[model samples]
Target: MIPATSSTPPLAELRGIGKTYGTGEHAVDALVGADLAIYPGEDMIIEGPSGSGKTTLISILGLLLRATTGSIRIGDREVGQLGERDLPALRAKTFGFVFQGFNLFPALTALENVALAIRMKDGKAKDPEGQARALLERVGLGPRAHHLPADMSGGQKQRVAIARALGGDPPILVGDEPTAALDTKTALSVMELLRGLASEHGRAVVVVTHDPRLERFADRVVRVEDGRIESNLPRLAQAS
Candidate 1:
């Protein structure tokens, strides 16, 4: 176990992280001593080919996976040793996630979907419906708040997903190939929305994608290859 420190104040930190699958001769190293730090309002893009541990890194960062041998910290809290039951609260309070597939309920309206996330975080919060409606409006989905996922277009569905992810007002947003099925223009629009969330709202946004065009919207682009960070570079900010 790595020694815990109290100096660093990043939103997320990974130190000497390593993950392996299988055993003996069949062992596959997914991550090898990977270290990363993300601060608030940072829009980071992780780029790499398939099977390069990009997803593994995102899963660990999002608290969905544990490192086999390393320390992970979210804010000042050390999460590398937390129990499974404790993870949900941390995830709900600290991070929002948007996936390639819009994981919205087909039968539920957009408003309901967003409200469900809020209710999951705080079952006793009282007026979750009203809060969800406001979030939908904030995401420019007010007109279609009553429409189900089936009734919305791909972009609209993604927007609704964004709204749902923001239900708890998390400080960090994690997205995994969120633009996979969208057209180039739509993908750019989604990237813009994510960037806006980081810059305008001061949320740390981390995106894992293979799209090179997305570098345009990233504040920092960290390329991963063979379970390691090959390069990390900063990019010019897009004008609002």
Candidate 2:
């Protein structure tokens, strides 16, 4: 295991970030002058209605999409100017992603899905089956590790997705509407798992969601409207 650094900087920082699509009269600004900071051990929820730029922001933060303007720093590296070739390496080293649909491969079992991600990072043919099993167990999916995604419940699939996201042990975890498809109870369980990843494991977790119940799970809530931040508030001290 890699030793934890005593004085690591913030996991991610975005300054004056802006993203625009198209040109001239057809131009649409998805994000405008947005700025944010995410620190280790922090759970942040970005809340917005449709077209409010929550997805756009997550993409930028995850290094999947570039900002048209402003600077973004992931740890000590400035990613705003990195070439396309450099992004895969940086993404593999620093970030993990969870999607709303779970995005698990149909042919692969839960364990294999996570093992694939671990393999991507280490570039070794060595089986990551044991590591994947440990991760599944951590997320309360130990018994389902050998099951294909189709055999699992909605909540179970999401749990497998979470385990896969953490398989590489990346410092920053980004989720795009992870609970959009779950029932209330299952959604709460997923949120609890994400909270544990941030608070207990010291990962910076950013989630995009419109579910009001998530307000209880987040340390900070950032509301975005019209492609800009409308408000950023820390949950009441007692709430956490």
Candidate 3:
């Protein structure tokens, strides 16, 4: 796969990673010996059929789940073994998350939603409203700041979600099917915004998706199957 460009260590590193669920006969291997280095300045895409462990890998990388085997290094910290209590704080400081479903608070306005995310990330926001408005404007949602989630279109809501995810300015941005709910044109626009998070903002990005449209924006394409990495190679050329 295309490696990170920086001379320093990777943004996130995984080695000999494996995960299993349950025990004995009921146990199922969900990931196997997955080695990867996600770096800033690159957009990485993980594509595979259902049950390929794509979600599991992202979970481990984002510190939402710990691997049963192997090590995960973020900066100088070996966080693979950190306890659940410690992980939440680290995850809040290190990762920004977006999902297929726009997970915005129903009762909160667009501005309030993003501001809440910012507050959660740092435990304090000097001016949450101002920071939230700026983020909304960045994602093309400034005019919709006062609107509630129900008042916006699917695309608009996702944009608000994106703005919220950026609230922390976390080092790594992880997306699980960020574009799955939108139309072709809207999906492209959302992907464009996601791509900018890597290339423009220099945050490492990893996305798990089935959409081929995302292939163009990716610096590396990884395919997984039956819980193993089938291919971990860079694309010869990206689509237009």
Give per-model TM-scores. 0.92, 0.92, 0.93
Q: Across residues 162-239, which tens digit of lDDT does each residue of candidate 3 receive?
A: 889888678888999889898999999888888887865568778889887778878889898999988877776432
lDDT score, candidate 2, position 111: 93
Query: Local error of candidate 2 at 190, Å?
Result: 0.7
lDDT values for all models = 0.87, 0.87, 0.87
For model 1, the stretches where C-alpha displacement exceeds 4 angstroms are: 1-8, 236-240
Taking every candidate in turn, the Cα RMSD to the unseen true structure, in Å, is: 4.7, 3.5, 2.2
lDDT per residue (tens digit) for residues 141-195 in model 1: 8999999899888988999999998887898899999999799998899888888
lDDT of 2 by residue, 104-203 (tens): 9999999999898788787773568888888999999998888999999999999999999887688888999999999999999999999888865678
Model 2 global lDDT (CA atoms, 0 to 1): 0.87
* Model 1 lDDT at residue 203: 79
Deviation (Å) of 175 in candidate 3: 0.4
Which consecutive 10 residues in model 3 have the weakest lDDT in total? 1-10
Question: Any residue pairs clashing in model 3, and if so which?
Answer: none
| lDDT value, residue 63 of candidate 3 | 87
